[model samples]
Target: MSDAERQRRIAEAAYHKARERGFQGDRHLDDWLEAERELDRQEPRRP
Candidate 1:
């Protein structure tokens, strides 16, 4: 799968996991998701 698609799945899983654990604050999730994307971008791609 493409990087973007992988990121989307990761974000979705994070969201559901947070919800299951009773996490509050929309900003918290957003910040985590944004950080994940940034990290992904910074990582070197495999051949």
Candidate 2:
């Protein structure tokens, strides 16, 4: 996928995670990083 699409997925994941956690303070950055990492883990490698 394109960079924008990747970003959108990550943002959506982070938003959901934050909501699940009750939208507490200062977790958005954590949410984004965790979401991105989770996505990376699920993606297949070509090399």
Number of clashing residue pairs, candidate 2: 0
Task: List all candidate RMSDs to the true structure.
Answer: 4.4, 1.8
Among these predicted structures, which one has the highest TM-score? 2
Give the C-alpha lDDT of model 2. 0.89
Question: TM-score, each model?
Answer: 0.50, 0.86
Highest-scoring model, lDDT = 2
Q: Which stretches of candidate 2 lie over 4 Å from their true place?
A: 44-47
Model 1 TM: 0.50
Q: Cα deviation in Å at residue 32, candidate 2?
A: 0.3
Model 2 earns a TM-score of 0.86
Candidate 1, 1-46: lDDT as tens digits: 5788767766776776577658866666675676576656866456
